[model samples]
Target: MKLRLILSFFLFTTCFTAFGQEKKNAVIVEKGLIKVSVMYPYAEGKTFNMEYYETKHMPMVAGFLGANLVKYTIEKGIASGIPNQPLPFMAIGTFYVKSLSDYQAAIAPNRDGIRADFSNYTNITPVILVSEVIK
Candidate 1:
């Protein structure tokens, strides 16, 4: 239920801001890879431990998922497009996979263990975004 809501919100946001005056066909096509974004948003009084996320958490992710993960990119959000403005997210970690099945297969079995490790780094809940890359 919660995940569905989050995914729905992500979808809406992506469609709204994905391109600047570009048409649908120009932005997205049928054939592309699956991309997942794990976003940790910033709060007024909250903090994000970038060191732990990079050094410990992501390594564990790579270890458990192994070959299923095609590639990954980690972003530490700095600010909005407006200069000196704070970013909405603290960090965003993205993972790539060949297919939805591959993502499901790799994550389902290790969900609990992976989730448990969140306490080692962050207190804020993360938003997850799953999308197909544009061709």
Candidate 2:
């Protein structure tokens, strides 16, 4: 009876542990999907308003992209891999879309308005990269 009790407890623990270790469902993007990355390189005396970016800027951009925008992510730099080293980018905004041409068409009419709103947030001239998601 003692051996049976110990074995049951061990089995229960092992099952619980296995269930707890299950991996999270990750976002999956197809290989040919378009990825647009906007990076703001870090600089001394440069300013970034994370609040405005999150609340106003990104939403506005996403709205402009409309149905063409699959999904998006915003990242704020906090630390460098090397201790005491300056972080590379102040912030990064990336969006995934099905077609690059569709994204361009959606943004064309709103480009002027989008550019105009930049001053409401930061002074950084954002670096833009358009690429295909290979992974």
Candidate 3:
């Protein structure tokens, strides 16, 4: 009788635990989507105007990207995982587009203007990464 009660309790707890677990919503990207990340590396003497970048530069860049741009995100670095370590990047700007060619075409004409606007925000040379979204 005791063994039966213990078994029932274990089964109840297992089922309860399983049901109580939270499910995370997954974001699925469509095929052929391209992700562009522009990372600004941190340096002692480097200067970054977050306000100008957020308010002016990104909006202008998005305008240049036009309808080709699906969405864009900007992230500011706060702290490193390791204590007392310097952050690798000061800021990161990422944009998603359906077609790489479309993105390229959109930015091609405005490339010089985009580059010219950098001095208004930061002195750091941005590292750019273009990749295909797998998931």
Point to the candidate with the largest TM-score: 2
lDDT of 3 at 87: 90
TM-score of each: 0.72, 0.80, 0.76
For model 1, which pairs clash?
A: none
Number of colliding residue pairs in model 3: 0
- Expressed as tens digits, the lDDT of each residue in 65-126 for candidate 3 is 87778888899999878899999899999888888898899899899999999999999999
Model 1, residue 98: C-alpha shift (Å): 0.8
Ranking by lDDT: 2, 3, 1
lDDT of 2 at 117: 92
Better of 2 and 3 by lDDT: 2
- Backbone clash count, each prediction separately: 0, 0, 0
Name model 3 segments beyond 4 Å from true.
Answer: 1-31
Model 1: per-residue lDDT, tens digit, 36-63?
A: 8999988887778899999999878877
Candidate 2 vs 3: which has more TM-score: 2
Better of 1 and 3 by TM-score: 3
Pairs of residues at least 3 apart in sequence or in different chains that clash in candidate 3: none
